[model samples]
Target chain A: MIESVHEVLTRSALVSVAATLVAAVIGIGLGTALALARIPGKQLMTAVVNTGMAVPTVVIGLAVALLLWRSGPLGHLDLMYTVHGMVLAQVLIATPLITGITLAAMRLLPSALPDQLRALGANRAQLVLRMWIEARIPLLAAAMAGFGKAISEVGAVTIVGGNIHGHTQVMTTAIVERVGRGDFNSALLYGAVLLALAFAVNGLLASVRHRGASWERN
Target chain B: MGAELSLRQVRQVRAGREVLRIDALDIGPGEHMSVLGPNGAGKTTLLRLLVGVDRPTSGTVTLDGVSTARRGVEVRRRVAYATQQPGLLSTSVRRNVELPLRWRKVPRRERARLVAEALDRLRVAHLADRPAQTLSGGEQQRVNLARALAIDPEVLLLDEPAAGLDAQTRSAFFADLEQALADRATTVVQVSHRAEEALRFADRVVVLVEGSVHQVGAPEALHHRPADASVAALVGYDNLVSATVRTDGEVLVGGAPTGLLHRGPAGAATVAVFAGGVLLADAHGPGLPVRVARVIPGPGHHVLALEGAVSLLAHLPMRVQAPLTGDVVRVVFDPVLSVVLPDSPADPTPGVLDGVELAYPSRVPS
Candidate 1:
């Protein structure tokens, strides 16, 4: 039991780390694009992003698993039941969270910033970059929250990656597996680690928000 | 770095509603022009169109003989427009000032020197390193001005730059602006609601009403000889009376001849009497009888509200004695002081005036 617990801990840590990096890259990129796009159906796109934020992890896992299955159209890449598959599922769930939160943050910036930039002769690209940098801290907090959410989710990884030993197992899945196998101590240890990670992410976000508010007052 | 600006019949329509309609305007190089108007008179919109921040629905805004609509970027580089509310990037003041130079691809050494000079000119050098979000309103406005000046554009467009500033700060800002203009061949087109500021600094004043230019002339002409009733009201003519042309061509006020008459043909018109133009004297003086209603002290004069069948106000100097309420008095005004406007058919209310037409051209013949 002790050996199995150690193996699961190591595998879960690796999967969490890999999934977090992938999710951050895709989520933050798409999130920013969605925030700045001036498409005709922008409000509808925003609504879809907001709805994605509330979707259960199991739903994302099932949808992504079905799409990557051997009989599915995208099965040519053969990503099912692997670490890449799990990362894909996590990014799918996390991207909307990042995009929605980023949109909200950009909305909070003063309305005059864009006009002012244009009046200063800033090209469209410069305006976008400057506005993004101005909104960086809040966007970072949002991306971090998405990272934590993806790292802590169990159902998505369990279904899409099959929670394979030494391959796709992640923190939440590993904790559930440990509990099922009567290794209560291992489950408790993993739970404690997850709680600590969540606390750290939330603490960082709180500090950023407080700092931003102070900057506004001055 | 002065550029000539000419707007020929520029009209801007948004969502089927006309936002700005300027028939014609010509601002020469090194000229300082002020636009005075009430709220929603399209002052900001006109400024935006002139700077290429907005495109007109029809007509043209040309800078130095180049059409801004066709040459957007080139025109923008030549004009610096500052909005009424200061807009700053969510970055350091230095970075905000460095933006225009960065856009022009200016070298780092030159950019730094220009930014420093602009900040120093606006007296906000101490705030160069601080984030713009940390600055006060006045400081932010100064920083905005610094950023606009950093590029040293030929034309400067200011929209209500001194609206929220204190009197002392406003005066200082105007003085700094004057010095800056003197140092460079910069042409300025500013929009302001403050009459005193416009009178003090503007070489010419243009009055806009309801999205159209009502009058344009030298500052003193607009102040003393407003083109119409709207211009008169905007220039601080607070005492307006609706009078009928009696048979003898004299204007009768409350059933008595006041010796004020229109220079044009006799007809219904609204006569505008500036508060300063109405003189108050003791009851024995040779003028129309009036009853003193109230005396209100102003910045440099005492405003006396006189009552009869019609109430009038006289703004006398501070040394003038205040008359008690209900005390009989006499009021007189120079016949030239009153501006009579032809009555409009839309407004038939006996004592309420709508539009007033001018009899003489207000501009001095060149």
Candidate 2:
């Protein structure tokens, strides 16, 4: 029982971290582009991103499962009921949330900041990089928000990963399996572990935020 | 090491409306020039053009004969702009002053030296390690100026550096600013709405009105010999009484002799009277009679608002007994404190008793 709990916790951590990293890379880049570039259809694209953030995790899971099911469009890859499919589903769920937060963060900066940077001899690339550095506190918060959302979700991982013992079980699906077998003690144990995992991640993120904010001290 | 900035036929149009139009203007190397204008006169737009942040709608703002808009980063590296707002980064004062030097790829050792020198110049060196966002308003402004001066650019653009400070702080801010630029051979252009602030240390002053250059001359020229009635009001002249120039060069106000003479064309003209020049006279004296409406006391003088043939304001010395409200007294104009200018079509002398148009050109062709 102890070994099974440890395996589930490690797999959950790996899947969520991998998904968050991929989503953050795509989302932060796209969000910054949307915020600064003068492109057509910007309003429409922002609306689509905002709507994506509100989508249900179960709905994304169903879509990903369908894409990976036998004889489906992407069936040949045979990724159904696997860790890869679970990570893909979580990525879809977290990307929009990160993107929306990043876009809002960039817009909240002082409007004259870009011009001030340019006048100080910063070129295009330097301007964006400096703006990102200036807004690090909020951008760090966006990443944390994305990671939290990706880890706590269960309905999508269950539908896609199948909770197969020893292979594709994460903490969320393991808690469901333990409860179904009338194993209340094991279910409660998994629940406590999941809560500790969230607290640990949040603690780490808070430390990073505090370090970034230290420069603001009087 | 300073760069000469010249604007020839520069016109900036925003939202399909012309905001700034300068036919031709030049600032010599190492010279300090001030652009004085009221709000919405496009002073900021002109500054942005000169800084190469935004290209003018037409014509060119050239630095040392090179187009600011067309030339790329190399040209911009030689110029620095300090905006009205502090706009400090959320970092230490030392970093805020050091980043520009770093962007210019200055060596780390040299960057530290320049940053220290700039902070010392603005007298904010003690706040170097403090977070820039935590400083007081005055401190923030000093840091902003220090950041701009740290780059050691050839041309510096200051857009109302002391804009939102109180009277005392504004004075002190300008003093520090002047000290910072004292020995640097950098061409500087500052814009402001206050006459005292704008003319304090400028080698030449540009009076911009309604997006046009009304006059560009020495600070004394703007004070004593304004181009027109509007320019007079901008430069601290409080009374713009309409008058006429006789064929013999005598001045008449309200169809009575003013005992002042002007060499302008003998027709409609305005007597731009500095309040210091409006003197009190006896009821039987040779001047226009007016009833004192109000008297406001100041440190060393009293300001009297008088009503009669023309609404007028006068600043009288404290030694002279001030006229009480409702007292009807005659007033005379001191020729040394007033001058006759070509009547302004834009701000027509409101109560002019005469109207015969004459073509009298201004000192600076408008």
Candidate 3:
């Protein structure tokens, strides 16, 4: 039971790390673009992103599964039930969360930053980069919260990732499978590990928030 | 090199309201021009238009004959604008000062030197490593000024740079600014509510009233001969009285007549006299009957409120022995220093003290 728990925990951690890295890259890029773009229908776009944040992981998983199945348009790529499919599902869920939070954070930034940058002769690209830097810590906090939410989610990946041994099985799905099979010991161990990961992410967030708050107070 | 800035009939309409309207304004090379106006007088809007941050609805703003709209990017590189509230990054003061140079892609060595020089000039070198948010209001303002000066732009637009500064700090800041402008041939255009500062620092002063250029001239001229009552109020004329223009060319204030020359209308007029222009007398002098109302002490002078048939204020040297409040006294006016306005026909009996006009013309050399 102990060895099985260790194996499941290891695989879940690996998948979680991969998903978070992919999500961060895609989420931050798209989030920044959405936040800064001054296009028509921007409010609608923001509404869509906000709606995406409230979507259940299970719904996203089912939607992705339908799109990647043999009968679907992109079935030719044969990505169904693969680890990459699960990664895509997690990225989809995390992207909007990061984007929404980032947009909100940018909005909260003092209105003076952009004007000051422009007055200093900074072009659009330079202004965007400077504003991002000015808003870095908050952005990081938003991204991390999205990463935490993505890693801890189970319903979406379990349905689409098809928990295969030594392949698609991740910690959350494996723990559920273990519990269903009456392997209480292994399930308990996996649960503990998952809890630890969540704790660490939260701890990091708190520390960052404390530093940012003090910086603001000063 | 210094560049001349000119605005030709610039007008801005935002949200269906005219935010700024300026006729022809010509700022010479290396000249320091001060913009004086009350809040909401479109001073900031005008500055933004000049710096190309906001496009004018009509007309044009040019730097050295180059149209601002046609060369906004190039023009921005030559103009630096500092807002009233200095906008600093969430980073250290050093980083804030280094931003403009970094945007221009200055070499690391040059950027470092420039940042150091700017910090030193603002007397905030010790705060280089501290986060900008840690500074006091005055410190933050100086940092903002330093950041704007980092690029050494040819034209600097400052919006109330000394608003939150102490007297000593403000003097020091202005002294450093003067030195920097003299050395670099930079043209400064500052917006200020402090009339005295405007008069002392600016070669040319422009007054704005309700989105229009009310007056423009040398600081002294604006002070002495305000274009209207509004201009007189702006330049700190404290004695504004509602008087009737009598037929004999003298103005009657509260039934007592003073030898103030008037023409045109006999209905009503506004008599504006600078506090410095009113002279205090023990008894009835050549002016009019007055009673001492209040004696308020000020920085360099004492403000005496004399209650005659018309109330007036006299600003005299602080060392002079002055009558206390309620003391009977008389006052005299210098006709050369007084401005008489014909009553607006629309409101013939304009209430004695309803609206005070504080917008005035700029002071110009006589």
Candidate 4:
């Protein structure tokens, strides 16, 4: 039983990590772009992002399930019931969270900063670079939230990945499976392992953020 | 290498209202010109136009005959603006000053050299290694100015850099600023409502009123001969009274001959007597009769608010025996020092004040 728990735990950890890693890259980039663009309907876009942040994991799961269901539009990719399908769902769920937080943080910056930069001969690209450096701490928080959201979410991954044992099951889905099988002991063990994994990732992020280091300062 | 900045027929309309209108104004190469005005006078708007950070609603802001709009990138490289608030990054002062040079893509060797020179010129070299966020208001402003100078800009635009500093710090800061500016042939255009500092620093001054030029002259000339009563009050003329011009070129205040002369046509005019322009004398002959309403002591002079048919403010040198409040004495007006500003028929007299019951409310004390 303990050996089976170990295999399940490892499998779950791999899925969660894969989902989080892909989500971070896409979310941060899309979020930063959304915050910087000055197009019309910005308020409407912001409202949509806010609503997306509140979207249920189950809704995302069902949507991805339909899209990759062999008869669906993206069925040719054969990603349904696969770890990649689970990652795509997680990315969708986390991108708006990042965009909303990043937009708020960027707006909090002093209004005089951009004007002063232009007067000093900085162009658009340079202004964006400077803004990133200046708002790095908040941007890091956005990344942290995205990772947390992707890892802790269950319904979406469970639906898209089908919770197949030793194949596509992540930590969240594994715990749900253990409980379903009436295996109380295994469920508790999986839950503990999930907590430790989350702690490690966030701890690493916190250390980097607080240290800020000479490189970021420069 | 200084740039000649000019504004021609510049009219700025904000929110469907004309906020600024300049027919023609020019700043010579390497000249220090200060735009002096009260609040809402569009002084900042003018500075922003010169730096190419903002475009005028209509008309051209040109540098060396090239319109700022046509050569924005090139013009921005030549001008550096130091705003009122110090927009410093939370980094070392050295890094803060180096950012502009970096933005301009100056070579690493030259960047370091220029940054160090600017920091030293602003007298902030000792704080170079310190984080810019930890500096005081004055120190931060110094660093802010150093960043502007790092590019070796030909034109420097300052928006009240010394505004938040204490008197001693402000004077000291400008002394350092002057010394630093003397090092380079930079044309400085500063916007200041503080007359004393503007007078001390600028070679030429443009007095703006409600987004229009009221007067443009040297500090001394503007102080001595304001364009009108409004301009006179701005330059610190404490006692403004209504007077009429005489055919003999004399001014009459309350039907009393002032012995002052103006080339104005014989009609109604406004008289501006600065507190320092009038005095109380113990001469053998009688002067104007006045009762002292208040006497405020100063470092070298005592400012007396005298009460008569009309209230007069006089600043006289400290006497061995100073006159007490409510004491009646004779006051003398220095015709050479006072100014006679012609009043248009449409403009109301600033002299006809309301409710000046501070001296004599209803009846004079016997």
lDDT of each: 0.77, 0.86, 0.78, 0.80
Measured against the true structure, the TM-scores of the candidates, in listed sequence, are 0.88, 0.91, 0.88, 0.89
Which ranges in model 3 have alpha carbons more than 4 Å from their true place? A1-11, A29-35, A199-218, B246-248, B262-268, B299-301, B316-321, B343-366
Models sorted by lDDT, best on top: 2, 4, 3, 1
Please give the distance, in angstroms, between residue B153's alpha carbon in candidate 3 and its true position after superposition.
0.6
Deviation of model 3 at B44, angstroms = 1.0
Chain A of candidate 2 gets a TM-score of: 0.94
Model 1 DockQ (Cα-based): 0.43
User: Please, what are the lDDT tens digits per residue for candidate 4 over residues A161-185?
Assistant: 9888777877788888879999888
lDDT of 1 by residue, B134-216 (tens): 78888888888888888998999999987799988888888887776678889999997767776677889999988999889
Per residue, candidate 4 scores C-alpha lDDT tens digits across B286-329 of 34567899989988888788887578988776643558998887
Candidate 2 per-residue lDDT, tens place, B1-366, comes to 789999999999989899999999999999999999999888888889898989998998999999989885777889989999989998899999998898899999999999999999999999999989889999999999999999998999999989889999988888888888888999999999988888999999998888999889999888867777778888888888888878887778887666566665678888888787677754674667789999999878999999988899988888777878999987766666777875634322212212221111111112
TM-score of chain A of each: 0.83, 0.94, 0.87, 0.89
**Clashing pairs in model 1?**
A218-B134
Candidate 3: count the clashes.
11
Supply DockQ values for each candidate: 0.43, 0.70, 0.53, 0.58
Candidate 3 or 4, higher TM-score? 4
Best candidate, lDDT-wise?
2
Write the residue-wise lDDT of candidate 3 on B171-273 in tens digits: 8778877765667778889998778777767989998878888789999888666766677788887888887787766677777655555655676778787
Could you tell me which 10 consecutive residues in candidate 2 chain B have the lowest summed lDDT? Answer: B357-366
| Top DockQ hit | 2
